[model samples]
Target: MRTRTRIAPVALAAVLVAGGTMLAAGQAGAAPKAGPAVKATCYGGAKYYTSTAGGGSSNAHWPATGTWAYTTSNCNDINVKSDVSLSVKVCFKKTGSCNGWTSAKAGVWTVVAKDVLHGSGFYLQFNRTSSSKGWIAY
Candidate 1:
């Protein structure tokens, strides 16, 4: 009778421990939901002179050099580390000599390291010829 009493407690303890372990493992397997991308304003930017002709379709300079303004009210949650660098790209297509970025024409680009952040630079293409690329560092 004493052996039976001891066995019952041990079996109960084992079951409780197993249940707790499973609960922890289940939580670990769940993935966090993705958040939305932040909306940024055109805090400031620079304009570059291009030479081509009818419309500004080409990058003027295949490997052009330029910089744009970026202001993030809150960057606390992003993967951007304290020492993160910056490289912003705007896709504006033209033919020959263009007037630069108009009020319209905007697109998303793969923001990469300008220079400082252990990155070579940012490169993108419009067509086979007119393309834009540059580097940034601090």
Candidate 2:
């Protein structure tokens, strides 16, 4: 014959309490959840300028010359706005190499940057089929 073993209510209560305490302790000793990293803002204030019909802003003059503005510590993209629809791009170095033009609508924040390499320096150029005005933030 098999003998039946039963846990008393008091003993069962102790087991549950101990198990809960162990679980709580383990969780407390675990590492805390990490927070998201903050993105770097533009190094300075936004730049405002005007583009004449079929013309563009002067080459790579913002962020000052010889300075890298889109590195790890700097901005990777820029925010742009305009009074009328326009095109924007990043022109780098003396070769006049540029990223594809990104279209920006009137009064909207359009973030632009592409094919950006670390340590590469660039400036914003705004183009319009007609005269246009805009401001850009790195």
Candidate 3:
């Protein structure tokens, strides 16, 4: 009876140790889960793009290098994200008109432009303190 009791406890301990090791190994071998994707809404429904950060206050012009994606549809609004706090706006390509610049906080989505010029193709403009990269979604 003494031997049997010792054996049972030893077996249980072994089983528990092996189970814990397996659980830890499984977790270590598993692939890391990714964060939720950033999504935005547009006319055709949603869009996003990584763009070069623009610095300084410029008017009536979208940076030639700042655009990452383009659409023919009229987007309801423009959202921007950056490493630094900044301002952004949207402009009609043909009409040469632009909405007022709005502030976007660091690493957050800010509705920069609420009204884009209808029936005209549009692009984004940024006025940042630094040249850090940013994202635009609509």
Candidate 4:
């Protein structure tokens, strides 16, 4: 009886140690998987890109000051839309270069650029002669 009890404990401890080692080894050998790709959206003729994942309708209107708010993180795309033909400008910073203007026709959602924005922040401006106009970003 003494021998049997001693052997059982030793065997149990060995098995537990081995199992723990195998678990550690398996985790160490596995490569980390990449995250899901972010989705881009075009609404009412404007484009928006975000790392966040979800589905919903987005409002399309220029900011009250004509400047779109953006984060310091990566910006994946530039989108533009309007009720009539208009020009759009995207800048790295508020005071930075205009990058150039893209012409977007009325009622047509357009992607001016994509995968072009890196980690730098950016904003959008809509150039329209008409009093009625709007745009949005994500």
**By TM-score, who's the top model here?**
3
TM-score for every candidate vs. truth? 0.26, 0.45, 0.47, 0.43
lDDT of 4 by residue, 45-101 (tens): 333322121123422223433445553223356555455676666665545766667
Estimate every model's Cα lDDT from 0 to 1: 0.31, 0.59, 0.58, 0.52
- Candidate 3 per-residue lDDT over residues 14-106, each given as its tens digit: 999999999988865652331121232232353444444444553322435544334424344566666677677777666678777787788
Taking the tens digit of each residue's C-alpha lDDT, what string does model 2 give over 31-129?
233111122234245568555344244442344445435433334556677777767787776456877788888897677774355565566666544
- Model 4 stretches with alpha carbons more than 4 Å out: 1-62, 66-68, 71-75, 116-120, 135-137
Candidate RMSDs in Å, in order, are 14.4, 10.6, 10.1, 11.2
**Whole-model lDDT, model 1:** 0.31
Rate residue 135 of model 3 by lDDT.
60
lDDT of 3 at 84: 70
Clash pairs for candidate 4: 45-80, 45-81, 45-109, 47-79, 61-135, 62-135
- Between candidates 1 and 3, which one is better according to TM-score? 3
The local lDDT score (0 to 100) that residue 106 gets in candidate 2 is 88
State residue 68's C-alpha deviation in candidate 3, in Å. 8.9
Model 3 residue 77 CA deviation (Å) reads 1.5
